[model samples]
Target: MTLQLERDAVLRRHIGPVALAAAVINGVVGAGIFTLPAAMARAAGAWAPLSYLVCAIAMSFVVVCFAEAGSRLPTSGGVYGTVAFAFGPAAGFVCGMLTWMASVLACGGIAGALADTVGTVLPGIAAGPGRALVIIVSIGAIAFVNMRGVREAAWMVTAATLVKLVPLLLFVAVGAVMVLSGSVPPPRPITAPHVFGLATAVLLGVFAFSGMETPLAASGEVANGNRTVPRALFGAMGFVLVLYVAIQLVAQSLLGASLGGQAAPLAAAAARIGPVARMLLVVGAALSMLGWIGSDILGAPRILFAFARDGLLPRVLGRAHRRTHAPDAAIVVHAVIAAGLALSGSFTGLVVASTLNTAGLYFLGCGAAWVLHRRRIQTVGEPVDFRLLPVAAAGGMVAMAVLIYVAPPAEILGLVGVLAASIALYGIMRGIGGRARPPVG
Candidate 1:
């Protein structure tokens, strides 16, 4: 009966490589990019582009590990499934919880950001019930789209990515011409005194490229997932790297020293071009949030579905809607939790905890890639790309270690609490004779 239920709940394979790449793009580029210019400028001034490059190079190591694992274990659980396959169910459960919590926290944080952005245009929606209402409506819309089907969700994500990119690309193109014409000056060169600032900027910039793995959580619904996953990841990463560098350079060129002061640096840069351009960037900021929320809705619930399917969580969450083949219950639950966090304004702590959660994921992801390759495992997709696997895994692990070593004390304590709680819950489930199943071949 249990096995039958699992088989019946399998998701449909509708997400193609291009759609999946769009989803990955949405996941990687979020509300962060809108204000990233100011933050990076504050940390490293005109040398912000260098910080972005450093972070991208470091993140490339991790991306290589993910490319291999995502190709090999093209399943619903994504990072969790890979870690579990390489380690065990208990470890997988812990890693899954970490990834899910980070993603959910990010959703709530982004929701709050969206409400704030809307508030700029419509002051009434900025705070109190107005804010809460906006959060609810936004999340509800995303949840509704996700429930319709993954294909619909993918289409929505692709559209959102286009909407989000247009304004920024315009900003980059116009700003570049301005610099060439001397309407805007070139960015100032970095000095020796800014080395510490450069480090800080790089540290923060590393996370800007995260959320790629979130979309992979729905690998089970991807058509030709093994081939599709790696292609989407690498393609999205390359596009994002180039786009980020260009945006940073343009912002720095136009704003110069004042770039660090604007709350909406891109909008501020656009304002120099004209009022219409500023409005476009502001609107783009809100739409970008919507796109990210949509992508999160599309992918994160698959973690809950996978957990339940494995008997690590309640079985109800594992059930899929018959017609749509979507994990309807898990989708609702994920949105509800995120909305609750947004409305209560308690996601601040979760946001802080998310940094550590991300570090844990990186470590597990790197370890999984190495162990799986060593075992000659290739459950799906093309054969493991062993050429760079060794160097990439080792570098990824070292990078994660630096992240952990530099984390603040509060974040460390929070991570410890999260991990301990996950372990306790897993034990309780096992003690109650949960029908935990082994990994499916």
Candidate 2:
């Protein structure tokens, strides 16, 4: 029931760098991006992009750390694997809990958002059982797709990523044309930056970029993960950063001072383009949610598999389907958990702590990268690029700490509660290790 446990079944490595990048894009650009322009405008006004830039700067450090760790230790569980490698089983267990909980909670919240999007169109599924049904059907569908095979799941993620990006790019393209011409007034220059508001905006931007880590959870299913991880991280992040900045600039230019007030800022901007464009945004938003859910299902369950493989959870979860080579049991359980959270209405309340959990994982990941470099450890895969590893690791940790420090006290307490529970669960896992350790296949 330890790391030395026999693996009777194994995951297939079908995910290449391109598929991984698509998963990263799908993860980062979800339902939030459609409305994020308005939220950023509210916080930082004309200087919203500056906040994005700051967030990107901070995230780049963290991403580099992940790239390094992923290259050196291309295993399942993403940051959890890295932490366990750098630290120990105890710390690794906590990291796994944090990572899995964050993804599952976010999945529930996004499932709710998807139902809301459906409600906008049908209005019947706006609340109650209708909303619950949407959550179940959506997450259930994604889970099924993931259970089929990694290749099929990767294709779904890639398709969803492309579909979701079209409307946003269209919005940016139309807005850009209007701005370049005389159709829309140019964005007003900000005479002064709002420091506190900008800080808040950066926090929001960080959350928008949070899902990138989730995709790494399936590292074991990735081909040449050492090379794929860094390539996907850099490629997808660059695309997202440019796309986000453009969308924000265009929305600000089109809406001007009125940007922050609109609930659906992208739709509002699209409306100015025409009804067709606006409709596209509506459809795109729903697709975006689906894409994110697909990516979450495709990757997050691997965390459960990783946990079980290490004897921290039921070993049945570590088993892959004989034919499909997919973690079917883990995928189903993760989906069930998310569906329950979505129905219980607690996911919304817990989202702040979910973000905090992600930030904490990133901090630990940065530390792991630092430790790996310090000890010159190469547990698996190819050697990672160590250039700027120390400086990047420090900056990443600081960035995560800033996010953690800025979080509400209640959410901080909630994070602590999760950690404490994880510790207790780890003890229980150890106590019943024999019972939990089932045959892998």
Candidate 3:
């Protein structure tokens, strides 16, 4: 009984709606927004904003599915818990491993981006040992804070989210003024329809929206997981959709045909505003990347903790710090892997690998929702309609299929390798007495 109580105390429910919303925002709005504009503009030309809108609309379906599943399980593992409840331990283990891999890779990519941003402002730290040190130090700082406690980590994430948004808000305001005053030039006419370009734009836009489910991973730490998770998910999605589309439009209006050529389109757009705006943008981009890393650090370890508790991973990772009530072991392990990747300077490859894993997770998560709905399982939160749940699931499945179809060949090969390895590992574990099953809530 004492052990049970101790275990219960290890993960306290301290996160409220506001902090949850902030985490959701931080997870969804990262450095991708600042960098993807040029690539998107090149892909869809003047129609890039349209692609953002379309992708957001499509992603809403997946968000709904996540909302329903998260509400029902309201556990630390996010999709892993939901999938396990519907499927079995093996399936859940696969989902958890995939989610963990994607998140760690994403954290590494953000660390690299943070290093680049620092390098931009201070050329002295642009490459070599300086860059490596920045990556290591930044990831170490985030991991330390997360090990302190969930509340502390959530508050830090909240502050970072607000700080990161300041420059983006400024850009939107200035862009609005320019548009209203007719100071911004009109977009160039498309000489011909570009189907391939639109497809590429859609893929990039979908990838940008990948972090929507991040906050759900920490639902166990939330005060009102059922209601809060769904509300925060929708709210964050709506907020980011407006912010992304506005930025795309502003970039197009300010740079026009020149938007596609510049390496940093948002920074280029800010240059038109003045040196102060440009400086603020540089700072904002750095903070946004940091916030992404912070959010991932806080959430991803919880999935590991869940996996450990369920016998999929080493039981040591399931333990939390006695005083801080943080998943210390899992956080340290995750940070080590992420730091290694960051130090290797494989940001683009990590991003691609994560994207591929995320596609599989989305499909499995949505399918889990369908299985739960069919079983008529009792859920904790606002009840979803029977008919609507399957529709949401179907939408998510189709979206994931499209994403997987468009994925680069390298990512596909990496994903296959990871799956094969996971299967072998699962078999070896099962050969031992490692299949201690936990009851699905």
Candidate 4:
């Protein structure tokens, strides 16, 4: 018990429920929300909003399982810790590796989005070394903020979340007023092709919900994590679901058929109000992407830190700064890797690959929840029924499996190669006496 407490003390417990909720909100609401309306409209027509609601309902099951697991472990590495306890070191390693990869790729994708948004406002920023510089600087600044400490980083996330959400809410409010006043035209009836379109939109909607698990990654640093983490997760999910559905409704109401071809549907919707609204929407998009980058940098490195803590990697990577209590080395390593990926100019492909990889990882997490429940693992938070755990786990796994089938073949092949490499690396680490020790409860 002393050893466990000593280990826990290494990470400062400064994140409260509000900050944790902010982290969750920031994680799930990335650059995707700014652009997804057009794609969903193109696929599902007037039914796009329904697709978001359906996907949200499906994702709630997974979130419940994650909450139970996270509350049980209340440690850094989120799913990594849960798998390590329920399965073994090998499964845990693979879970952490896949999650870490997805986060890095996500950061790269967001950085590219930020560059593109900036270039739209100020031309010449997207071409040549200018684009690369913007990506690096953006990522580097977020990393520096995170390196300062969790408290500072959490505040930054909260600020960014508020900044990005205002414009979205404003657009929704305007559209709602128009509808209530009978100024907006009614949406067209769904056609035969729209049924298939709903399926596609649901798939895309599920992908947008991918980052909800991020707050749990830093559980060790959260005050009252056992309770706070779960509350934050559910709260953030509910908030995003309402916001997403509202945005979709607004976009469809205003843009109608024109929404299908719009590259920036929300911004275009805002333009219906005027140029100032359009400019504000663009700024919101930039802030939204920046918030995601900040949140990813804050969450992803905890996996490496957890791995190091368990002896899967060098101990130095797990070391927190003396004054700031931040995982300095791990944060630096994540920044370097993400910056390298951003320069590759494969942001869209990387996003697709990471989406598929994340689905598999979430499935593993559901399995871990089931195993933990069956084993009756002692938890510090509210106890969940063993029967409920299995039901949620099964439902989440099935959802993820469906998502996997929808993934592109090229991304699946890439995932396979990455898994193979992880296996080889695991073997090498084991040979060198680097096998991780089991977590102490």
Please give the distance, in angstroms, between residue 297's alpha carbon in candidate 3 and its true position after superposition.
1.9
- For model 4, residues 170-248, the per-residue Cα lDDT tens digits are 9899877876687756645433345666666776787688886666767878777667877888898999999999998
* Model 2: lDDT to the true structure: 0.79
Which order, best to worst by lDDT? 2, 1, 4, 3
lDDT of 1 by residue, 1-441 (tens): 011114214679799989888878877887768877777887787778888888888789898899887777677767777787778878888898888887887788778767866776688767899989999999999999899999999898778878887888888998789788987545454333266666557656766788887777777788776688888889999999999999998887777777776656788788887889888988998889888888788878988887787677887999999999999999999999999888775333444456568878888899999987777676544644658798999999898777766666777887788889988878887767565664533
Sort the predicted structures by TM-score, highest score first. Answer: 3, 4, 1, 2
**Residue 380 displacement (Å), model 4:** 1.8
Q: What C-alpha RMSD separates each model from the true structure?
A: 4.3, 4.4, 4.1, 3.6
User: Each model's C-alpha lDDT?
Assistant: 0.79, 0.79, 0.77, 0.78
Between candidates 2 and 3, name the one with more favorable lDDT: 2
Minimum summed lDDT over a 10-residue window in model 1 is located at 1-10
lDDT of 3 by residue, 1-441 (tens): 001112224578888877777777777787767777877877888889899988887788788888777665567657777787678877777777788888888788778877876876788988999999999999999999999999989888767777888898899899778777987566564332288878667777776888766767667677766677778788888888999999988877777788777645677788777778878888888777777788889888888887677666678999999999999999999999999988874555676678778878888999998876676554444544446888989988998878767767777888888778777766666666556474354
> Which residue pairs show collisions in model 4?
none
- Candidate 2: clashing pairs of residues: none
**Model 2 TM-score?**
0.84
* Segments in model 3 whose C-alpha atoms lie over 4 Å from true places: 1-19, 147-152, 182-197, 221-228, 257-264, 315-329, 343-349
| Clash list (residue pairs), candidate 3 | none
TM-score of each: 0.85, 0.84, 0.86, 0.85
- Indicate the worst ten consecutive residues by lDDT in candidate 2: 1-10
Candidate 1: where is the Cα deviation over 4 Å?
1-19, 124-129, 144-155, 184-200, 220-228, 314-329, 343-352, 380-382
